[model samples]
Target: MAPALNVELAAEPRSAARSRRATTEWLASVCGYASSCDIGQDIVLAVNEAVSNGIEHAYADEDGVVTVCGRIEHTAPERRPDGAGPCGAFEVCIEVSDNGRWRPPAADPGHRGRGLMMAEAAVDHLALDKGESGTVVTLRRRLGCPVSAS
Candidate 1:
């Protein structure tokens, strides 16, 4: 993709769905894949969980902004020892961040503490960085086999 996608949203309940929609639409156009594909849907789900966590936990007592960014990176494929030519590949990176202090999850979260777990399970890679100012959740997925065309 030539231009990266970025969106800033108010930390609210509706922002989760908004972020999901934006990610789905942007990724579909950028990757030239159907939005309903497994990889695309998995990425969308991870993004939604991250954004929702930012809105619900990060800014639980204060108003803040959540940012979502998405981009595609071209990678040089691994060269086989058999002297096969290099094949192009791509990796998708999505980051969700909020300008609010991190809050520890409740002791008995019950049905609410699975966001991070679900996010981690959905993507090939997931990371969380919490600092003094805010928290950032990064999700990455490599486009491999079964990537169907749109």
Candidate 2:
């Protein structure tokens, strides 16, 4: 059994912080406390990082909503389960979409450089797609939270 939670946030730059906090709250409600907190923290952090990049590079100054979706799907307990797609592995798919520029720009200058890298390291799979609407970065992860799904 998997629970699907989808959230849409404002296009403002500071919204990334709110997104992380909102995600933390959701994880707190569902994931509980203890080590799961750490796992959830990482997930939220990674998602925020990716979303921030999208806000900066993908949409630029365009006004659009950033959508982040988390889905839990039933898969073999040994595999990824808490993820977005059907691959299982306790994974998570975080998508940041904007109605602005779709193509990914070259990595930006220093300091703001590690967001994408951090996002990639936190998840198992990373996807960046551009279309007429905008660019979306989906990060997938199957790590942390050892809770059983029997």
Candidate 3:
């Protein structure tokens, strides 16, 4: 597969947009390489939402760092132990992490929240890890074919 895409940026409001653009470009490159752009768009939207949440909620007070990483995995179809058909397929994973504490979004209807919800709706799988140290959001989307040989 293509080398994992990585970016570290200041956890500022403006950085959210920058993160989105960088991720979009990387996804576009991967899609172009694979001749598949439809899925790339979905991945980009999900990643943007995750990054926005990191910048707005995770680092609400002081400056910190947000790390974005993208990777593609190609799994060859393999028979199941129960004599079932092959079950594995290709997938792309995107992770957006911030070295800042997590805070629940405001309850006000117009104040904040919704990024995670939007991200969840856009991706096949979504995972969230939160603790005193920081929060990490991972989004995964299944691909029809391998994007690269790696």
Question: Which of the numbered candidates is closest to the native, going by highest TM-score?
Answer: 1
lDDT of 1: 0.83
lDDT per model vs. reference: 0.83, 0.66, 0.77
Count: clashes, candidate 2: 11
Residue 42 C-alpha lDDT in model 1: 91
Expressed as tens digits, the lDDT of each residue in 1-150 for candidate 2 is 334557787777888988887676655554445334555767887888867866666655667787877765434545346554433245555675666675544576556477877877776778878788777777666645543442
Cα lDDT of model 3 by residue, 1-150, tens digit: 567889998877788778767877776565556333667667778888888777777766788888999887776665666866664466788889988988876678594577788889888899999988899899998764335454
Poorest 10 consecutive residues of model 3 by lDDT?
28-37
Using TM-score as the yardstick, the better of models 1 and 2 is: 1
Q: Which RMSD values do the candidates have, in order?
A: 3.8, 5.6, 4.4
Candidate 2, 128: how far from true, in Å?
A: 1.5
Model 3 segments more than 4 A misplaced: 33-36, 76-88
lDDT of 1 by residue, 1-150 (tens): 435769999999998889988988887777666545788789889999999999988876788999999887776565445766543367788899998989888899887799999999999899999999899999988765322243
TM-score of each: 0.85, 0.74, 0.81
Better of 1 and 3 by lDDT: 1
Error of 2 at 36 (Å): 4.6
TM-score of 3: 0.81
